[model samples]
Target: MTSTDRPLQALLAAHPADLPVPAVREALLQCVQPLTEREQVPLAQALGRVLAEDVVSPVDVPPHDNAAMDGYAFAGASLRPGEALRLRVVPHTVLAGGPAAARLGAGECVRIMTGAVMPEGADTVVPHERVQIEGSTLHLPADTVAPGSHRRCRGEDLRAGHSALPTGLTIGPAALGLLASLGLDRVPVVRRMRVACLSTGNELLEPGAPARPGAIYDSNRHTLRALLTRLGAEVIDLGVVPDEPAAIEAAFRRAAREADAILTSGGVGAGDADHTRQLMQRLGQVAFCHLAMRPGRPFAAGVLPAGDTAAARAPTCLFGLPGNPVAAMVSFLMIVRPALQRLMGATPQVPLPVPAHCTAALKKRPGRTEYLRALVQRQADGRLTATPAEHQGSGVLRSMLEANALIVLAHDQGPVAAGDSVDVLLFDGLL
Candidate 1:
C-alpha cells in the first residue's frame, strides 16, 4: 500500500527498525550519495566549511626549543645560596625567531627574553627581576632553578606528522587558528551545496504587497531560505508557483537540473489543489510521505534522476512540506535539515531534545505525536519551565514567532497535567 493508504503506526510497524528518529537518521546515512570534492580555499574563507581530509602538522608547532619566560639562562649547578654570580651579557642578543647565541658556562649567564631560544648548555632561567644588570654584566641571585625549568621544548603543542584536524570537522575560529599555527595558508574543504527554495499556493502573495481578498502573504519561503543559507547552502529563490501541476512540474524540472536539493513549502496534502505530490511522483521516486508527527504530518521526500547518461546518475533530493507556515518550518527543521546535511557529506545528524517541565496542562490526541509551541523560561529555582503559546493551531504563524521550543508530546500519550516533565526541541539559537 502507498504511504498515505496506511496509518502512521502501521507504516512504522512495517519497518520497525527504520521509523524511529535514530533509525531514520541511519537509513539516510546509508544512502550512497558522494560528498562534493574539496577545493583549496584561502585560510580566511574556510570558516564553516567541512574539512575534506585530515590535516597533519608539517613541522613542529613551536619549531624550536625556546624560553618560556624573560630571564637569565645559566647553569643551575653553579648557583649557591647567598652567593652572587656575574657574567657579560652576550651581544646581538637572541629574541623570538632569532638564532641561538653563545653557550653559557659555569658562573656565567645569558640575558634572555620570553620566547627566545635557549642557548646551548643553558638549562635554567632566572627571572629578570631576580637579577641586577650592571652595564653589560648580569648579576644572578644566589638561588637557581633545576634544569629545563623555563624552557619550552619543541613539539610541545604539536609534533610533526601529527593529525591536527580529522576529516569531517566543521572549520571554526579555533580550527583556523590551529591551521595558522601549522603554517598552512590554504585549506581543503568540501564545496558548498546549492539549494533551491519555492512556495506553492494560489492564495499566497509576497509580503508588503497589498493583500488581495482571501489571500495571505507568504512567509515560509523567506524563513526556509534564511535557514538554508545559514547552513552554508547556496540558496536560489524560485519565487512562488500557483496550485497548477504544469507550473509545479516545470519548477521541479528546473530545480532538478540546477540544484542539489529543492525545498518547496505547501501543496502536499489530500486536497485537489495540492499538486506538488503528484508532480514529485512523476519526476522522481518518492521515498516516503506523511510522518506520524503533528504540525508536520503532510511531508514528502524523493530523489529525481539527473538527465545525463554518461555521467554518474546523481539524484536531486526534494522535500515537500506542509502548507501551514508553522508546519512547513517544523518539518524542515526535523527532516529536511538532516537530509541536507547528509547530502553535504557531513557526519551523521542527531536531533537534540532537551527536557523541560510543562507549566500548564497539555491536551492532545493519543495516536499522533504533538509538538506544542512553547516559550521556555528559566525559573527562579534554576529549572526550565515551558509555557505553551496561546494559539496552538498549525496555521497560526504568529504563535511560532513567540515560541522558542517545541514541547514534544509523544505518541500514545494522553493529556498532560501541570508540572509534567516533557522533552522539548529547542529551535536554533533559542537555548
Candidate 2:
C-alpha cells in the first residue's frame, strides 16, 4: 500500500461491522471530505452546480428606486388629514427603461408605469384606480393612499456589495434568476462530481436481448444513472459485468482511475458467487459490509486505491449496494445520497421524517430499522396518513412504484397497530 492509503486503512480498522443506520451514516460522512476543484462558467451553464465562493452583488437588485406598478408619483408631504388633496399632472409620462423625468414642481405629479424609475423629488405613489383624474388635475380622497405606497425602494430586493449567493449553495432556477438580476455573466461553481456505476451477476442481461431462461434484465445501472444525474453528477456508466473476479477487478481499477466515487449493485450478499464483497475486501479498505437495516442490509463502504502510480490521484470512495432493485434504490436514497453531496462540495442534507398516521398494521422486529414502502396522503384535516404498499419484499420493485414515501420504523420499535403514529420520509422533494 502507498503512503496515501494509510489513513483509510486506519479508518477501516477503527470502524465496526453491522452498524445501525445513524451510526453508518455518521461514519461514512466522517470519512469523506469535499473536493476543492472549481471553475468559472457562464450563468446559463451553472445550473445545479455548487457555488465555490460567495457571490457579492456589484449593484443593487433594482439598481434604482422605481414604481412597483402604474401609479402617480408625488411627495407624500402634500397630503392633509381628513381632507382631499389635488395636484396638477406633469405633461411627461415616466416609462420603464426610458430616461429619468425632470424634478417635480410643488403640487405637481408625474404619471409612472410599472418598473419605471421614480421621478426626482417623489416619495409616494397612488395607483390609477385609487385616484380621480379631471383633465390636467389628479384628485385623491383623504386616507385613501398612504405615504411611500407602491414605490419599490432601491436595494429593497438585494442590496449592493452584499452576499447575493453564499458558498456551497446549489444553483437552481431561482439562483439563476438572482445571478442574472445582479448582471453577473459568469459564476464560480464546484466541478461536477464523477461517479462510476455498474451491475454484476451472471444471470443479468441487457434489456434489448432476447428472453432467456433463468436470466433477468439489468435495471440497476439505469436506475443508478438517473439518481446520479438528478444529483448533478457526471456518471460513468460501466455496463454489466459477469461474476468473474478478473472482470470485476478490471472494472474497479478503471472506475478508481476515472471517477471520484464508485457504486456497485449486486454480489454483496454472503453467497459463494458474491464476488463484489470479496473484491472490495481485496482491493479496498472495508468499513462495514452490513448494516442493521431491512431491505438493504448487505451494504458496503470504504476507500479504494486509484492504483495509478503516475497520476498519484487520491483514493476513490466505494459503495457496494445490494442486488435487489428496491434495496439498491432505497440504500442510495437513505445513505449514499448525502455522502455524495459532501464529496461535491455541497452541504449534506438528510430528509427529516414527519409524523403520519398509519392506516395498516405493520409487523417489525426490534433489533433492526425497517423502511416500509408507503403511500402518504394529506387528510382533509391537514394531517398526513401513510398506507403501506401491498408488497414489501426487497425484490419487489413495484412496491417502490406505488410508494411516494417510506415509513421509518426505529430499531427499538416493535409491531405497529392501526391508527398508530409513525415517522415517514416523503419522496416529494427528495426524489
Candidate 3:
C-alpha cells in the first residue's frame, strides 16, 4: 500500500499495544505530509511562515572588497616585516557608499572609512590609532599591522547565485533582514496551517463565569491555543464541549471542516466517558489511543472526515490528548506540535535535551518514561541545575507556570538522586 493509504493502520501494525516515545515520534514524522499550498507575501508579513523555495542571492553581499573599519587602505606587498613602513597619503578620502577611489600608486595609501570600497591595488587596512601621521605621510610601527588584515573581500558574506535561505525554513527576524538585503519585497511561503482546538468534559466551565459545584475552569483550550499560535499555526478555538455524543460529534465535524488539524482534550483517557472515542471510531481511523509515558500516557491520533461529500476538503488530522490540564499541554508539545509543523510545510526540529544536575531526589518506575516539571537555573559557574516543582500531578495546572523546563527520565531509567545529571527540555524555544 502507498504510504498515505491507511497510514494510521500501517503505523499501528508496526508498533506494540502501548506506543513508546520514540515510536510515537517516528509515526508522526512518517505519516504526516507537508501541505502544498503557497502564497506570495511581503517580507514584512513573512515572519514565522515557511519558505516555499530557495532564495538565491542576486548579487554578492558587500558587492566589493571593502575596508572593514575606519582606516587607511594600502597595498600589503609594500610592508616589510621588521621595519616601519611609510607611504604618502592620497589627498582624497573615500567614504562608504560614495564613488570608489583611484588605483593606488607604489608607496601611496588612501584614507578610507568603514564599509568603503578598497582602492584598486590595495588589499589591507590599518586602523587610524595603529599608525602615526606625519604631514601627508602614514607611518606603521614594526610588526604592529599584518598584511591583508581588516579588509572584507568581495562575496565574502554570500556569493551571487548562492542560496541565502533554503526551502522549508521558517522565516525569522534575521531571515527577513537577509531577504531585505537582497532587495526582495516579497517572498513565496507556505500558507499557515489551520488548527482547531476544543476541551471536553461536562464539569468544565469557562473563566469569568460564576463558580459552580464540582465544576472547574477550562484551561486546556486556552493553553492549546497559545501553544498553536506560538508554533505559527492559525488557531480555531472550538471552545468547550460536553460529554454528550451529539455535541462532541458536531464539534469534531466542524473542526474537520474548518481546520487542517483538530485537537480535542478529554474523552480519550481510560476513565473518561466514551462518547468522543466512539464518535472518533465511527467518523475516522484511530491510530493509537494510549502510550507508555508519564503525565501523558493517554493519547490518540488519526484523521477525520472534513465533510459528507465525496469531493469535500481533505481529511483533517486528529490529535486526541488527555483531559488533564498538564497532561494535555505536555502531549501537545511532545507529539502534536511536531506533526503540525510538518503539515505546515516546515521541517520539524527535535528539542535538544540540555543536561543539568538535579537538585532533588525523584522516584520512578522502569517501564514508563516520565517528564518532571522543573525550574532550571544556571549557576554562577554556568552549570544548569533542575529543581522539581512542588506538585507534579497531571491535574496541577499551576505547576506548569511554576516551571520553565521538564526533566526527562528515560523508560529504562530508575530513581534519580540529588546532584544526578539528567536531560532537560527547556521551554524557552518550545513554548
Candidate 4:
C-alpha cells in the first residue's frame, strides 16, 4: 500500500511508524548515517573499502612525451610520398624508460624504443620492419607512416593536478591499481562497519553437531555471515540464541555494546516463543512491520543504543528477518543488503532488473508482492524466458539452490500468463 493511504497515513501521524515494503526500505536506508571518521591504509588493504575523500594526482602519467613503439623517430615533413628516403641512424639507442639524449636534425633519424622520451624535433615514427637498416645508415619508405603516429603524449592517461578518484567509491582491484599508477603507497578510506549476526529459535542447532528428533541445523547464521563479509563488514557472529527473553536480551545487549549493526534471523513473529520484538521494545526502539510481500513479509529494523541514558554510545542498527530458510535469505537480500551498503559509507546502489518472458503459467495474487525462484534462460531468438520451479514454498531451500534468478511481482500484479514480460533479478555476477 502507498504511504499516503488513509489508515497508514493516520497511523504514521499518531504513533510509532509502521510502513509498507518500499516505505520501510526508505526508512532503513535513511538510518545509514554519514561517516566522518577516516583512516589511511596500505593499498593492499584498501580493497572493498570506501574512500573518505577525493584523491588528486600528484604528477602527470608519463611525465614527458615518449615514444609509443620501437622505431625511427623523425619529422614527417621530410618524407616524400611514394619514394624512399635515406637518413643516418644515431649510434646511441634510446631504450624504453630512459632519457632521450639525441636530437634529430634534417635528414637524420634516432633509433627509438617503446616508452622512451621523444627526441627533440621528431614528430613521427616508422616501424623498424618498414625500414631497411644498413651499417651506420637507414632507409625509410616515404609513405610508410603518418605524422604524430605512435607517440604517447605526457598526461594522456591522467592530467596533472586533476581528480584521480572521487570520494564514496568502493575500492576494488582496478581502483587500487590506478592509485599505484599515481605512486600512492596508501589511501584514505572510511573504517569498516562492525556487524553482529545471530540466529534465534529453540529448534535450531549449529552444524557439525548431532540434531535431535525435532531440532534442525541453523543455516541462517552461516548465510548472514557470508553475506556480511561480502558487504565488507567486520562480522561478530553471535551464533544461535534460544527462545527465552533473557537470552535474547543478553545477545542484543552484547551486540549493541560491540557492533555498529545487528542482524537476526527469525523470531519477529507475534508468537509466544518469539520474544525478539518484545525485548526490542524494552531495551531499544524498533519498528515491526508486516509488509505486503510474500515469503518475507515480516521485517523489523531500528536502533538500540548502548546504555539507558539518552546520550549513550552510537546506536546499533538491527535487522530482524523471518524464520523460514528461503524467506530469511530473500528478506536479507531485498532489505538488509542495501541498508548495510549505505551504513558502510557506500553510495546508494540499486539492483538492475532484466525483462524476461514467462514460459509457463503461474498463479499470483493481487494486493501482495511475490518473489518466485526461477531459472532465467535465453531463448534461441534472444528473448529471456523465466520458468518458475514446480514448488514455491517458503521453507524449501532446494528451490533457492536450483534457481539462478528471482521473478519480481509488484503488489498490484495479478496472475502471470505465458509470453508475459516480467522483471527478473539475477542472483549471480552482481555480488
lDDT of 4: 0.81
- Best-fitting candidate, scored by TM-score: 3
After superposing all C-alphas onto the true structure, candidate 1 shows an RMSD in angstroms of: 5.1
lDDT of 1 by residue, 387-420 (tens): 9999988889898889988898876788998998
Cα RMSD to native, each candidate? Answer: 5.1, 2.6, 1.9, 4.2
Per-residue lDDT tens digits for candidate 3, residues 76-104, read 99888899999999999999999889999
Q: How well does candidate 2 score on lDDT at residue 154?
A: 93
lDDT of 4 at 327: 89
Question: Please, what are the lDDT tens digits per residue for candidate 2 over residues 1-431?
Answer: 12234443444465555557776676667778787889999989999999999999999979898998898999988987798999999988999999779999899999999999998999898998999999999999999777888899999989998989998898999999999999999999999999999998888999999989999999989989999999999999989989888999999989988899999887777664667778888997765457678889887777788786526676888888887889998899888998899889888888889999999999988878899999999999998999999989999987888999999999889999999999999987677
- Tens digit per residue, CA lDDT, model 4, 1-431: 11122333343455343345565566567566655668999988999999999999998986888888888888878877788889888787788867785778888888888888888988788888888988979987667777788888889989889999999898988889899999999999998888999988788888988869999999888987888898888999998888888898899999988888899877787663678788987787676667677788777767788655434456777788888878888888877787787777887565888999988887888776788999999988988999998789998988987999999987778998998999999988444
Candidate 1, superposed: residue stretches over 4 Å from native: 1-19, 67-94, 106-114, 121-152, 308-313, 351-390, 399-401, 405-431
Give Cα distance to truth, residue 223, candidate 2, Å.
0.7
Stretches of model 4 off by over 4 angstroms after superposition: 1-20, 76-91, 123-146, 308-312, 365-368, 378-384, 411-415
Q: Which stretches in model 3 have alpha-carbon errors above 4 Å?
A: 1-11, 14-16, 308-312
Model 2 regions lying over 4 Å from their true place: 1-17
